[model samples]
Target: MRLLLCFLLLLATTLPARAEVAGEMAAALREQGLTGAVWALVTPEGVATGAAGLADAGTGAAMRPDHRVQMGSVTKTVLATGVLRLVTLGHLSLDQPLADILPTVAIDNPWAATHPLRLRHLLDHTSGLDDARLWQVFSRRPVADTPLMQGIARDGQALRLRWPPGQRFSYSNTGYTLLGMVVEAVTGERYEAWLDRAFLTPLGMRDSTFGFVTQTGPGADPRLAMGHFDDGSTQAAIPWFTRPAGQFTTSAADMARLAQFLMGDGMIDGVPFIASDLLRTMGRQTGTAAARAGLPIGYALGLQIRDRHGVVGLCHSGNIVGYRAMLCLYPDQGKAFFISVNADSETASYPALDAILIRALSLPPVTPLPTAADPERAKWQGIYTPLPNRFDQFAYLDGLTATVMVMAVPDGLLLTNMQRPDRMLLPLGNGLFRQQDRTIASHVFMEDADGVSFSDGGQSYQRVPAWRFWLGWLSVGAGLLGLGWLLLIGLWRLVLGPRSLGGMVSISALLALMLPAPFLIWGQSFLALGDATVGSVLLAVVTGLLPIALLATLFLDRRRTGLLPWLDRLASLATLQWLTVLAVAGLLPFRLWG
Candidate 1:
């Protein structure tokens, strides 16, 4: 009787403390313009769940802990868990080649004879597959009931491998969708039904679901929170084509149960739901060169090994159209937390909430040991550009701005890039390095058939010659200057009386370049380019014709000897050179719909 009384007193003191922390998190969400948020924190002591703001801003419905929201890519974790469970049950093998599992699915892999795509590569995103293309993500038709094989056939171009399988890491939603297909291939059951029966029910996540949820149907969940944009506009629950990759709707209380199950010993009610050894393997990556070089941090199976405020944890963040979610698990310390916001606000303070929760739990910090400078740092200095992008359609833009320069500094190397601030890489020996602010080794330098390259697990950068680097920038500069000059000359000629064919060509070039600006400025959605519309069709036609116009202008004005003609010819040549670069980069004919 005395022990029971003491336990009750302890619980009474902790509840108020937890409530106070929850209040602070709510305030942080409001300050960042998020309309609604739900969070769950699980520790050895107990679990705390809370909600704040309005679930439906228009209807004035208050958010509740049981309200469901789109979990986005966090659904990958659940799918990966299902795959691992199959492995444990002897129904599948991680190293099994994808061709053996789905024989009819077309895959374009140059290394198929040697390094065939494997189940492990798909799970860890090292399968060399590109992410979803524009049409796949922004389909004009409803995707709620589209057959998996049909969808795969429609977007077969994304199945082309960018590199050898299991060579490096690159996040690919298409890879996860393939894994879902594998689940069906093996079990002869839909992935959603199998996952629900095998994992969700056992874990007691009753309110969570893996399929699309509607807003006005008889089966619609009234507890579903309405998704919001940064501008306070609401979004309807639209089904995604890649259902297994990012289509789960779950509640905070349900996520808290999942966190507890993940942090535990794979046991529920004294039954082994998953083998402890297999569960331990889910947090460590093994299919990449960086993993082979003893790098400890990366995207493993589903969760990412992340360092937050000096504490190492397994985490996964999710973002769909109008929702963002995060799940963080510190299994070593027996702590975990899940957070989601209805509004995909640019100014949302996720890091601030992370800090507050970390402080609240009093998690221990990690400090890296001091190491000697790399003796062979000179070999690592050079200009490097990221190889095949995650999205094939944007590869040209990525090559332009994502190049980086690695230069040797006093105690480390400085990584200079045009898009971000310079970062210092401190050597941790054996060709592995970490950023100055990071506690774990996150960068690896290695040599492959393509020569020396560096990787941060997700993207790899290959060394390029100094001359090639300078040539690329010079060509871009000359093209921009020529276009500006043409625009001015053409406008001046228009104001004055007679216009030459050269002046008309200049004006046409200017219009081609500026045609897509208004659509981008007003529509503010990449989905607009994914399907045939007036804007996209016009862009395709103009871009395709601009080069021909410039070439014709150059040819027709060749015999003319006046200063104006000569200058016009030179400008056309410059613009033509730029167009050649774009053509080589695969940007000509700009057919974005496919």
Candidate 2:
């Protein structure tokens, strides 16, 4: 006990306090089974930058604030500024429909409404477009089959209208891709090149660039801070086809400069980078408070606007497979905070970091939870769901199933994926709660005598009865068993009735078809297709059904019961083939709808 106290005291005293924020941040990563690199900057007058842990744990290189790391969705904040600059220049307008900008380029499946998706919708992420990707768009090589717009059109056309245009907010990466196209159309330049000329060059951001991972160059060091999985194993940098949406690389110094630019009212080094009117416009409320209440304030163009202790600020966060970043600017106080992690644990460091910055800057921090707000209390307990958006379900996938989680936190509640529990949401008075670094507005719960309903922004979900889980599984098992019984009965009929070889082939095909029948009947859009392969289907028929039919022939012959041995071998192969098909199909539901 003495040794334990001494150790604790030593740790408390020795850990970097302001710098220990990094250690606290690092500890947060470790607690969630994640490890990688972190670059954090808390600026009172100038930036105090620090790094903790490894850039590449496998290589033993210590993380440095100077080391370049992927900024993920932080790129969106910058790109949104660029797109808005175009809008402010009379090259585009927020009210103008997207169809007017690039008349020739089809948007694919446009929302059927009088008010088509506009530049405001794209910048603030109110566009109803389903998130889709064109892998070829971000490729260094020429795209052969799938073009970005074509894929958008194909998938977008099929998507059900989740919400009418601008009726409810939904974050769609596809919207940014559309905005990227607008940049190209208005500037007569490629999107990345325009970013270089408009945002990076003007701001003198020397180290930042977009699509470095996909673009061929010696520029992006593959040896830079590597992203890691929750288990601390390395994660490969994702190849982003939508560069503007979530792809950029920078050092802490560069990000700090960007933060300064945002905090400085769109000016850097005396040269006006963007009009101040444009900056304010970008931070303007695009969605209503009632529509997006749980949010800290509301989403601005590529930024979330909210007030901490009555100080209104603009902020944004980024996440890719292995990276996460948060950037904040307090315009009223002329202060900013930037934090990035190479191995993202999906923890909410923004709130903690915000508190630290406010304290460090001598500005009042956001109101802290009262001592009375015990997390252990039942009033703060219950399952809460976040607002509906594109990334909500996909953000949290369990082993092979998707799950909605309710966070039971002190003074606040969070509903998140099993994977990302750190996105804790605090009630913003009334039923509203904030999520996504407090940029998104949403509500927590609506209760009644029957059960609880989880709503975000405006959408609602009733509690799924517990029995539905078992009943679902039971139904699937019964379906598979029933198919098996049909197969056995068919085998008996073939043997007793002297069916022809053609009839036998037809029966085999039928069984092959039936093997996947259960999934097609009861699968989600993503799972119904499964990992189905034509070869697997063929194997199922040849090995399982054909042999069964042949065994029936032998049983009818009675003298040919000897052939049952060969029939048994075929039946075993058939079973193996069907099991493989079913296994692949089973895995699909977990991936898509889990």
Candidate 3:
């Protein structure tokens, strides 16, 4: 009888808001080049849903309420809730050391003895694991969580923690993936199955599903929504084995129920899935990353805690390849909203829709920025990055961009990126600096060797000697000049004529060898790096000639005169210098053979 009632409720369009917002959002999504999207708003009274656009933009097929979209990292909320439920039952503990819980999975903590990874760290995105990597988990076919977990253990020995556990937040999908394995270990059931039994059934969510999903052809699974590209082409969903990190798919109505259950006591049909106490713990601030940095943002379990005037809003957003999702909860008002789009468009209408609904229906409007001046703000000026020694080769550029420069303005402090000087950050600050935007970014300064190190939320950066940047700029100059000189010589030979084919062979061969390199990097992200293609073969050839490329140039042009000699010298010098940079950046040393 209960199941029947829930099923009917899931299908029945309860309120008029469905047709209204659906039309509004669908029209808006089309303007943004999105094929389709669904939005669900929940209140203490009940749930209302709206959707618009098409499931298949190419085929012009209208989207239905039943269409499922990928949740991406939004899967974390469900996974964390499951883990917390176990904690409520005394089967798990939030503070329990992860190394102790999953003794079989190999995770090395350089701060092992003192600051080991705790269960809460996994939920809060602070398990010290490397954030994300672009690699596929298949050869013949997609595998199970156990084997993938084992690979994380085996290959992850070299991947160090980005920061000490609980020191701050650095969003890590690897940590969540390991947590999925922990669920398998604890309940003796796969993540997908356990989630069904725990939250889905009780909360009356029937359409949601998980695990690696693959489609051989377009519209292979019509029940599942295809991710639409900006060009109106659809991408068949691939098998994503990182189930815990992502791989969740659900309907908007079901997602709203999940959001409602999160802000509540976790009770359904007068039974508590997890105790009210534990549910409260999920909302309580675990780390002081935001508070200490004077940011309004706070993270509790898998949820990002935000501020609206004085009301607290628990939220999370997910974006992977083709889909985007945002879920916001206003506990004070007992209201929440979930918005997701099938197409990845920059001009998506969800953000504007969110603000409109959040203001008129949910929480009070946010407080406006104050006009106050601080003269002593000069004390906070410095360059800062993600704490000390957190940079690894795998995420070198990400680490470099984390660097921020603090400049004192007449009214307040301005934060700027050294790598992107054009960008400016106007932050709110009284004593500690904070962002006035929807995000909870905070900036704090601490004592350093030369000056103060600036910490933005979880990432810390220290002021380095200006010469370091000057050296990098010089390297860039040498690389560009050399490449241009060779290009000019190539054009001259093609049209004006080369004295010998020898000059053309060496220069062109060298260029051809390195041609596949950038493609390898792009393929690693777009496709799979290990996927053997013609480009991969050329990349291997480049790596084989890594040391000998410069040597051959010296031999070929050693006796030459005029521009040929300098061109060879400069191009070879640039190649060597660029190779050195890549090596230092950890972008080098990929599989060069087979």
Best by lDDT: 1
Tens-place lDDT per residue, model 2, 438-543, is: 4334344544553565544323344544465344445455545544644674587587965544335435644665554454454422212322333334334444
How much lDDT does candidate 3 score? Answer: 0.66
Model 2: pairs clashing at backbone N, Cα or C within 3 Å: 16-20, 294-433, 294-442, 295-440, 295-441, 387-456, 402-594, 442-457, 495-552
TM-scores, one per candidate: 0.94, 0.63, 0.85
Q: Provide the overall lDDT of each model, using Cα atoms, as 2-decimal numbers.
A: 0.81, 0.57, 0.66
* Top-down TM-score ranking: 1, 3, 2
User: For candidate 1, lDDT tens digit of each residue in 1-594?
Assistant: 999999999999888877887788778877888888888888898888888888888798988877888878999998898788888788889899999999888899999999999999899888888887776677555467777765554736436898899888888888998988999899898888888888799889988888788555667778889888888988767766677899898988888888888777888899888777777877688777878877787787788888768888999989887788889999988898898888877767677877777777788889875666688987899998887567767776776688889998888889999877899999888888888888888788887677888988668788989898889888988887777777788888878936777678768777777787677556545544576766677677788888898887777667778887777777777877988888887777676676
Better of 1 and 3 by TM-score: 1
Q: Which residue pairs overlap in candidate 3's backbone?
A: 384-461, 385-460, 385-461, 386-460, 387-460
Instruction: After the best TM-score superposition of candidate 1, give how far the Cα of residue 376 lies from its true spot, in angstroms.
Output: 3.1
Q: Quickly count the clashes in candidate 1.
A: 0
Off by over 4 Å in 1: 1-4, 153-158, 216-219, 512-528
Best by TM-score: 1
Candidate 1, position 147, lDDT: 70
